[model samples]
Target: MALLQLVLVLCAWWRPSAPAALPAHAINGTSPAASATVSDSRVRQERSVLTNYGGSVGLSPYFADLQGRPSPTPPTLTTELTPPPPKCMDEETCNPLARYRTISGRCNNLQSPHHGTPGQAMHTLLPQRYDSPAVFRMRAVGGGLLPNPRHVSLLMSLAPEGAKVEGNSLFVQMGQFIDHDFSITTTVREMTPGGKSVEVDCTACSSWYNPACAPIPVPLNDPYQPPHLPTGERRCLPMTRSVGYLVKDSQGRPVLSQPNFNTAFLDVSPVYGSNRCTAEDLRLHRDGMLESDENHLLTKRPADDFPLCFTEAGYCLHSGDKRVNENVGLTSIPHWSDERLYQEARRINIAQFQNFVYGEYVPLLLGYHTAAKMQLMPNHEGYFLGYDPTIDPGVYNEFSTAAFRMGHSQVPKYITFMNDKYEVTYHIPLHYAFFNNTMLALGNVFDPLVRGLLGVSMRPTDLKLVDSLGNKLFMEKGDPHSGRDLFALNVARGRDHGLAPYVEYLKMCGVKEEVSSFADLESLMRPESLALLARAYEDVRDIDLFSGGLAEVPLPGSLIGDRFWFESPAAGFTHAQLQSIRRVTLASVICGVLDQRNPRIPVHALQTPHPQSNPERRCSELLTVDLELWRETPHSPSPPCTHQGQSYQEGALVPVSPCLACVCQPGGKMRCQCDLSGCKQTQAAEDCYCRRICGYSTPHLKPQYRQ
Candidate 1:
């Protein structure tokens, strides 16, 4: 009973504990100090507790045990939230090839004439189509080489335009795939067989230009240097021959300096021979020129294939080949239904001009009489033949029709005429290849047609590949290097419908099999590259500024995986390779692709202004005025530039000195103060005197006194 009573007492006491109390005085607020004392006491107590037990980890065993007890429910584990991967960089969101397809779509969206808008009407154009299945099986082909249905139709219109397609017995369609609309009008005052010269107007001639193309004046000023004499007198003198060709220097004057006549250095050589012309055959091909008389020369016959002979001097009478039809007999080819006077005239003129300029002087000066000898085929087409007797089998300087489309000015009649005929050649593919070669041979610069064909987002030097997944396939190296092999590599992968036709062309050229794999594709395409490389001018090899202007297409970095950013050989960039790439355009690109598909295809440049019977005599006559002028007045020495305090003698560059007119002594500041009167002087007066010794006081010696 007592224990029970005690337990009850303990329970009642444990029910609640009394709160810590302040002093009675502090509670009653008797004295402010007393209240402060109570507060201080509390503060001391808290400080002691904190100081005695460093931190939670350093707490006493009792506190540790109290906190260490496990919770009824286990603690839940937590994880970090992460973000999703970035969207594919390329629009197509797949690979480089996929990206290219997307880019192509976007390019089409850019809306240009070449791209053609949706619903745009296309004419029914079905030109002749030729194919060679032996060389190509038609797998992995791209649209680069083959013309789209639209393009194919356009090529067919050449038939009505009076053009002929012929080669290796292949009935190919005639017409340029991408020629400028041009017109060439030649009014030749010809000496008729009746001993009377008649002026004939040949306006219906076909050329790279539109029939409406108007003649523009050609600035006759020398492209290399200013005329030694006054402009008028310069025009009067005969053209200056290449210095190396001359036995004596400029007539009476001693050769100031012999020019580097090393054609080897210039990289000019016959296509069939050595630079030295060592072999008799090579010598013949080197000296002689390719002169076509009758369209029969177009025959694939071995005899007609034989190159004509020529002399060291520019002449057409060198080779006595009997099969020559134009000069000998005006016979037509078996297929040609009509001997169109226009076509005949054009062929004659081209052949004649080639014969005329074979070894003749390439006038160094512009507008000189000898300048007439320079029948620069305005466009790349036809050949330059030497007619001289000693050298047989003349050199054939072939060019591309694309060349004819470039450069605007008064194209010489001879060039204009040759351009017309070459353009009409049915062997467009092969002719084009030759034309491209010829331009390089002529040291002519290639001007690409720029129309933002590629988007502005990409540069011309941008490396691009077709990502199979629709992502831009960029190169690993990036920038300029991208253009390096991208052209060749992509060309290797890309295909077009026209590829089969191209293969057929190769078969015609004696190629056994069509390009099969990328390796074979590269091998087939290598010739064109080699051709371009062969023609590469060492002088212009520094492709700095020229390459910077080419159009580039951005590609994905990698072909596989989600990362579009590529770092590969395709991405490599360099200024030199880019310069070469810049020379590429849709037309050139198309041509290259076509060449890969069909090796040795020809694309012809038009030959305008038909050659006459005696191109040599006429060319010589053209130089009469200039030659007489040179005889009248030789080049005089340049006058010396005289100026005060500076001596600029003849043949020396003009001197340019900074204004050092201010006079300073010792550590004095170099101040330039002009006279107010002189500041208002005319420019001429200032140039004559003010900028020289006119202004500034001489430094006066400081007075020194001995101590």
Candidate 2:
């Protein structure tokens, strides 16, 4: 009955519910209830009635009698009645983190690949069935270790000169490019019987049995809805939640995973998936040297597997990836004329995408020595170093909700683009990146002036003084309201994700010294930063991972702080595979994009000699690819691959990121293990024994004691 009442409320969100035979409820203007009822002309009148009458509580006079009087505040809510869960005693009878503690990582997983199936699942890619959530001594809030906005804030304090220091925006773009994979979630929208839309606010829906996950008629709101679509009609923006597959897995299977998207490569699917459409449009000619402006796309040609963007037609034309499909706003940027704007950006963006992970980002973040052992570098590709069919490939709770979020600090306050003499240009606030198509059409960030600081060498936008434009995330057209408290949210999200506190990760990461109170962080972080953390949280154990990590300065050369670096290769990766990932740089990805002669794209701009020497060069000119090689050749497969009927792009150059490494068990059959440990046979290695020595333990987990 309670479940039915919940459904009834959800139904009311679309329209007022009536008996099955009523078909059209004056209460909700023709809602199908659970049925797929379409909206009709009555929607507008109904909305008007709703607007003029009672906010959400309003109903037409015709149904006022049917609507029950407000049930007086349902008695103090019985003090949450749900019993305080059993404590985390010896893993055998512990609860899932969400139930055991606060509402964190429990519901954070991507909506399962089986989304829209009989039941939508949102389980962890790396599920630790045994539970003992991280314990916190103080109630956690968003900005654990930073100065409270009540006193001093980072963005408000950033000076003009400090804000202007440029980093390799290429890596920044790459970070966003890859972020699309890890941070994807769709706004679930519900149609009003009157054709109006209501964003579903699922805060009231409990995580374990969230009615929000139910086909409940609640629409989820998103920041990118208004502009991504060519039609400009608001579309539900579901970021691609697909496990990234480079090629076939170690088991020779099509490396599949859950809550993921169709795109398995590192192409610019954020805007274009190399998907092109129409003949007489500029398709890369097969001669490895010209354009096929008039010919039809081949059935199994490279265009089929790695399609070019029909950016000339418009940004919305033929984006192959699903993300563009979600946010049509990404398509249709007015600047995409002569295809120069979108196409040129693509060339540089993709080169950087491959380059960042392959050439510098990975090695710097993971540490060169560690990366080499994991075989994450391009040179390790042939030795069976980086493929494991069993790896979850799902983003981690700590990584996603907290650790990786450190990038927020690096966001700049402004973005600059060039037109002429650097004279015909626009230097706009970075938040304008989210501005309307007209402003974005003016070429906001595709220039070469903003290229070095985003690399490893430049300082992270100090956590205390993060850029306002990028951090606020959602701003109304030109509104300057720095709305969302991102750091506070990151801190909150970690708790929501049920991630352990900084100390737990520290212990597991093999930090021999103790971090008992917030004061202990003083040695590793800015004293001011520690003071800020002390203000928000009462106990040191209460410090959230993201806040704590951000507050601490990174290792001598690493991009992320020590916790994220240690947590990055969690038990899921093999040593060789980790090596390969560590060795990965933007260069490897650039090299693999072609089967022909390469372009002079520098994998890392900072690494290239005297980048300041060519500050005036266009991003397109600095990074390059042989467009001619991408042209479809006469000798190319006429009908494409045997599986062309599937409509899924089958082959394209995908630089490997870390993936699972599975080996044949004693039975000589393949078995999938999601442990982040390298090879288990070698028991004495550092990562293998580090957890136990540090006092964290999981029975089945060999490498990390935190199973």
Candidate 3:
């Protein structure tokens, strides 16, 4: 019943509506005079509505109800409800001419400023499957308690050794780096009488009373964990629920949704920081450069400033993303003096980062074929005209919680360090590297670590996790059991987020098999993996998303399965700008950072150094982004062209009609070409108006057509 109610609410929220046409002034980069029909206040209000609530104008009535106001009267088929736009939307503003993204990640999509902003709720691919409307999914399909996450982790994730993949450890490192760039779930905390927030300690009790506490209960006789105490108490790994907001379902019951602290785009938020304050803190405030030590490494923070730092140097390395301090290789990020230079530098860096992700990183991770299939690959030339503002580009819950977690399986037991000659110098166990920056701060270890990453092969994507992660994750120096099971935490986190079961995601990804029994998953999963899952889960339908997804057979030439592969939005770049950005490669970025002479690395940095396919290449051979393309040109006013009743600037795509391709030309001219392939030709050509707007096709329209 709860699921049904949640689905109904989501259905109402997601109901499709025709997006309003962009204002002529906004589209043509012209003065308000060009669109005199729309008042400035009205335009601002409309933009505010779109930005705050997404492109779905159908949500106005719901918003009214959500604000504790009387629900607006239902609209008839011919009319729509016109609720007063929220006051917050009226106050929210954007500068359409700004070239750089805001530090808060707002205004990237002009029509929807807050679409991918930090602290916004994550997009849900499917309706959440909570045990209750606002509770974690703790019950199995048979109305019994679900299997303990620790038990599942022990049965499925333990491996003596991990198999190596064709890619180097740098691939796994890059994945982790990119993962931090977008999604960071902030956990809930409690406040004291003085209003200071404190961490909710779930470890102090076997049964937690705090709603935020959802710690993993260590099962009895666990291989690595001690047995239950003489007082009949069990150990629990400390955990807290992610910070979330409660909204009303169709039945007026509360539904919890978690927010993502990072922006959804691949804008390198980890390097630049997610918000204005943090970005400013990391900046040197001169010449557009960030703070760094004399050696050009990240600036160190006072030991007392960082909660996780345990280094003897009485300080920890500071970064835009705090997680970078977890390991030595993880630290990876410029300038001009004027404010213009800072913005310009940020613009180019973001462009180059996007280019490498789409051009090299994604293709290698998803396999070139699959990447191309999903349209994730950038065009070698010409403008990418696939920008759609209506699409909510927020990170999906499934992707953040389950699919992207596949990298945890690829983590090697140790982080190896090698000399310039590629000779193994030393190694640090993965457990010891956590929260300890001693290895990074110790004399000249960064270069050796980079070499090791480039030289060592990463573990293949499989169900088995390395012993360090499966047994002693985040384990301190001497206490063998003073650690948590990462694999189990991953399982529990999914439930905390109320993610759907593995089978649901499989169906969503278009898997053909009807999975009623364990045997049905044989074609997709290994026999041993299936058996392990069978032993851990009560039913096939009850399998956690993270567990089942990791067990699936990897797609050909890809490290992950089909369900884990997802498409990212295209970078909205002009023809010349995009072409220049595409020149950037991961090798080039690495070369720019490495303080070495003639650093030789694989042309395809994400793959192993194959003699032929991915041959070793000097730093000079790698293609770097040409920042000259980003140089600011003085604004020169151009004449606007009028088409029908709208105005457009030269070279602008005119919104004449969907089936018609129209562009404004120089000298106040309008050029339109019609493609009626999907339209039925009637005796009266003028009466048959076939509409295809933003990929949505409408068969026939009357002569009185309006875009």
Candidate 4:
């Protein structure tokens, strides 16, 4: 009798309570009780389908397509499929005259309100080439199975040592920082009857039997990975397909397409957040400043917020992008004041960021010749009149998935920490810094890490990746076998997206006219690279876009190949604003957050420092954007001033000589000052102030005076 009573009590205690009902607003028009009834029935039906395939219902269509077999009958649902609700555009909320950009990126193009908004489909540069209508590309040109992604990675991605490049590590870091601002693909997640979403674990299922399982099986006697499992099974790297939905093409045929979780603009969405809700959460709601910790670093999230963090602090830094905590330099946040001042500061910061991307970053990545030839460089003077709303600014799938991934090759094996004299103090292996912030929380290592980035050169962009990335990426402590190969993952993701072959992109970019055989690429690729490609792929047309793109030689001085070079749209700014933005540089932006006492830095921070060509100088010597150009006139009536036979409102920049900039002051007066402050001066005339007969020749000279 006692044992029976104890068992009954334990069973009652362990019983879970029923899940709460969802609100009617969450399900559009359905009532709460009706939604619950329908949801319970739907869960049963979905679970039946999942059980039939051993928990891989999501991948059924893909396998059927690959095997040329009919798709399994889907379980009948109690409810009918309904179209999504129409998008509601609140004009008052998205004002055209508003100086700041919307958090959701809506109304960026007034003509097409949802052009660059999040959750929109990424633009396809060319037609997708899938093995079937809805399945991934799995067959070669001659109908044979394509080479395994792991085999391709092992043959092409390993290197004895990294080749050095002329650019500094900051160049690679900034590229990754900007790439996050462009596109982030969503992955599939299963929802339970309790309304909880969880990841679908494909690794526990049989390979290729479950539609969601696209595991890369390791070849026999692999160099890095274990040859076999303890149970005598083959080892496989797990990966899942990106979330996609079926859409009709021009011919009314269904095609698979992926959505970009991020807005397709370079608007610093990484710092500001992509959606209004996320943006609101990141703000302090006081003085228009972002929330930060006492140490001026990004604030830490709650203990239960990020379970992936494995540090003693038990939490990770919070930001619009999770990758922000990867490095210390990106974690620094700026303090702000009033609403107007905050808006003005954000505007100036974005303008300077855009200016740096075009004026310096793009030129170095694409080379000055290619950038100019493609008309991708910014104007030195006057306003940019090329703002066309008709051109969609959505990110291209080709660029995000394959071309921009070239940055992976530039990652060094280890991150170095240095002192004021550029001597190494200590270093950490690249894998140790992944998703771990223990080193950043200890003492004062931020400045030293930043100095190391500016002082050290990055590896050359090529086919080879470091051992840390190719063999031991994201490896946990004390576990040598708990790592994934990033190179293999990249190749697998390309096929999962059904992207076109490398030759197609080459033809689209006009890099090659005829690519019938591997011999045609002799001029563009080295002999060893060609041999490796031939060994991995059965045919020339079956090459993966990532593998082929990385194998080619970089264009003259550019870090990437011709296929990666594309023109970026210019932002809408006034003539005075453009002039001010043109003065901004990477060196100036880095200096803004550093300790004022030790503001010494390289003249060109993106390039490796040279004593004569690119020398170290005080931050004061760097040119920066003038925020006075963004000052707005008060609504109250104010007296106007005239300068150079033109009337201007208060706080407006007056048209004057190239070397002199005059601003309209209060009480109807004009204040004129020399724009070139740090230049060597020579008296040319009595009232003309300082003018040099030799002209401006310093590194800090204005963009217009660079020639």
lDDT for each of the candidates? 0.19, 0.33, 0.59, 0.60
Is 2 or 3 the stronger prediction by TM-score?
A: 3
Local accuracy of candidate 1 as per-residue lDDT tens digits, 1-707: 01011111111111111111111121223422210011223322321231122222222111111123221211111111011111221232233222111211112122221121111111111111211221111121331122111111111111111112111110000011101001111111335687653433212111102211111111122121122223222211111111111112233421111111111100111111111221122221211222222421111123222232111112211111111322212222222222222223222222222222221111211222434444421112211111111221111111111111111111110110011112311111111121111221121111110111110111011111112101111212222111111122111111111112233333445753553332333443333332222122111111111111111111222100001101111111112221222222212221221112222212211111223511111111221111111111114422334445554332122223222222221121222322223323344233433433344232232212122
Model 4 RMSD vs true structure: 16.4
lDDT of 3: 0.59
TM-score of 4: 0.74
| C-alpha-based local distance difference test score of model 2 | 0.33
Per-residue lDDT tens digits of candidate 2, residues 213-321?
2111112111211211244322221111112211233444322112222123343333332112221122333211113112111111222222222112122212121
Model 3 Cα lDDT, one tens digit per residue, 276-343: 77777877665455666665556678977754555656776665221122212111111223454555
Global local distance difference test of model 4: 0.60
Q: Candidate 3 regions off by >4 Å?
A: 1-92, 158-163, 191-196, 228-233, 251-253, 320-337, 561-577, 629-707
Which parts of model 1 are misplaced by more than 4 Å?
A: 1-279, 282-546, 551-707
Which stretches of candidate 4 lie above 4 Å from their native place? 1-94, 158-163, 191-198, 205-207, 250-254, 320-338, 561-577, 628-707
Write the residue-wise lDDT of candidate 4 on 1-707 in tens digits. Answer: 01011111111111111112111122123322210011223322321231122223322332222223244432221111111222332334455534456666787776787778787777788877665433566668876556667667776753233345678877877787678777887555666687655545555324344454576655443556764567766566676667666655686654567778787777666666777777677766654456666765556775456535555556666652221222221122223234544444445555666667777889889888999999888777653334556678888887888889998988776566567766665555566666666554563555566677778888888878776787777677777776777888888888877789998888888989778899888888877788778866768898989999888888888887010011111232445555766776777667644544646888887887788978888888887655445444446445778866778765455655434545555566766545443123332222233234224344344323222
